[model samples]
Target: MLAFYPRFIRTFDDLPGQLSLLIHAWNGCNMRCYGCHNADELIAKPPKDHLSGAQVVERLSGYDAMFDAVLFSGGEF
Candidate 1:
């Protein structure tokens, strides 16, 4: 199983399709629905740990040439 991270960024090379950056927007959720995939992270993440807009952009700067699209993931905005 893959361990979750609040700002997880990943890329897949073997998969067919446009190259993309998979970014987990946040490690949080507003509901406690049964069997949620991120249940553990939702309960464990601290709000203060979330990255600011500038930080996210900085982190993604190097990826500009690496992907053809950005796929944002995570629950809640």
Candidate 2:
């Protein structure tokens, strides 16, 4: 894993009526797709405030009831 910070909670308009939590679990990328918005940050250095896998799961578990689905976002999968 590149980096992790699981304390954040965000809602996105996926398809007008659908809303989901956008999980930002990692940073930096290897693919480097053209015109990607995260290219700058991904190419730079990984964040120092990242979390561990167990911590990520624990943090996410706190908001389990608030959302029906999750979206693993940021950089590569």
lDDT of each: 0.59, 0.63
TM-score of each: 0.53, 0.64
lDDT of 2: 0.63
lDDT of 2 by residue, 1-77 (tens): 54665445566664355567765656655566678654555346555677776777777787778877777656566
Stretches of candidate 2 above 4 Å error? Answer: 6-9, 41-45, 75-77
Error of 1 at 28 (Å): 3.1
TM-score of 2: 0.64
Maximum-lDDT candidate: 2
**lDDT per residue (tens digit) for residues 11-62 in model 1:** 6652457776765555454566677665565466544556655676777887
Can you list the residue pairs that collide in candidate 1?
none
**What TM-score does candidate 1 reach?**
0.53
